[model samples]
Target: MTKVISHVGFSTTARAGDLATLEDSIRRIVDLGADVAELALFGEDLIAGGRIIESRAKRLVEICAKFDIRYSVHGLIVSNFMDAAHLDWQKAVAKAMLELCRRIGADVLVQHSGQMPIGPRPMRERYDALEREALSEIADIAGKAGVRVALENIFAVADTEYRQTPSEVAETVRAVNHPALVGLIDFSHGYIETTRIGADFRAEIRAMAPVAGHLHVHDSFGRPYTMSKFYYTSEAIALGIGDLHMPLGWGDLPFDAIFDEIDPLPGTALIMEIGERFEAERADCLAKARDLAERVNRRFAADAA
Candidate 1:
């Protein structure tokens, strides 16, 4: 069968500013038989004040050269374009991240979908326009660097209104209309958001599949965190609430069904975003992701036939 997914791996859990730990994490991922390693660069201190720290960038490049693994970077989670006050700053950081992608030979840099503080509909519309402009510019930078900017769908919470749904993200990407900009479907986040809004999970995934260039493969019960009181993550796991980021098969996410239906674009990276709590299960999680990718590829081949 033709391959639909080009890479499969887990995100690194190493602490920022620690090259030894980063190397250790990549080495472990390579040992686990993964061909890709996603660098979650948000808190990694690799960039400061919207610029790449030249010394750190050099060291990072050196460290990665020691491994044979491909890379995909998760950009700063707080880089929101919807915030008009800091829009230029956001653009600067995004461009710097694209430069990092080029320096490290990464083809994809993932950014969470834009979110805005809750406000009136007119205000929200303005913010949406700002985001489109920002993403257009960001996409240009990424394209020039030979990288794709993947805008990931995020689940909404009480404090903010995330793009919230796969269709919404798809719409935004289409509006940007840039070849370098594509959708990233984080299935766990999609599950929670779709469940919250009473939408069919599979349908939503299928709708966004065509535009998707990256996938965050993890399991989660279709539950939103709405507890009135504070509790530990263990308690949330017990209740199956929120984005648990559980290892595949540990939660009720229908991976078999979802993969059977959606065919992400060729060369899409199917990354397992399992939390650090499930570290022992990383190998198994990657195995399951490979199996799912096979399923999708088979379907893709059959459709072509």
Candidate 2:
């Protein structure tokens, strides 16, 4: 029993165009006792037609190099492998993102799991197969770049018909069977999805824990969004209607129970993805994350004893 989690940190919200802001964000994360920074590279401007802009990439490297923290990249959120028409382009973007990770020395690139298909059963099956094929190729590129691609679980929304459950994502990673491809159990997403589908929440998480190499830890009441109207995110927070990304104690998620039940693989990066609105609570969130990591390590130590 050594430490089960290698890094406990927060995601940075700075955009590519604002290098100064990005530097400040990283400095704040480091000041808050975070050893890792999860860069949210979800903007379209970072990649152009499936290739990273070299100038932007170089600047990012220089900024990140100034910090003593580890790095992880959250790849383009809209790059969907399920979109059969754009699978090749998606693969190209994915490869380019992996190259960016290599350039910036990020060890993990977080990718969202495939979106649910909107057609017949056969079409859904075809999409699943396509995603696996695409990931296999992407994983090969990731391996060559010394980066691990962690497929993250996402919940379904009103517009999006459905999303893969934790078990389904785990199965996909296991099917790919590549060391460079692993599961990322976003607890908030798992809670929302399991609540939507009426599946056992803790059970779904436990099933996926064994394959988890990276984790997005945030607090969300297990409430899915509906057609109800909400003007601001604060309104959603008031009603607890969606993935609020609230601070740990701000939501009713049983984080203690979650850490008690699932043990992610050793060296997993447990990054807190608290929303930007909760910026003032960064120190508190970091402490809670450290406590949970210690709990997991204590459990492992006990098991070994």
What lDDT tens digits, residue by residue, belong to model 1 across residues 249-305? Answer: 989988998888887889989988875668799878888899998898887888899
lDDT of 2 by residue, 267-296 (tens): 899999885678898888999999998888
Which residue window of length 10 is worst by lDDT in model 1?
156-165
lDDT of the candidates, in the order given: 0.85, 0.86
| Candidate 2 whole-model C-alpha lDDT, 0 to 1 | 0.86
Candidate 1 residue pairs that clash: none
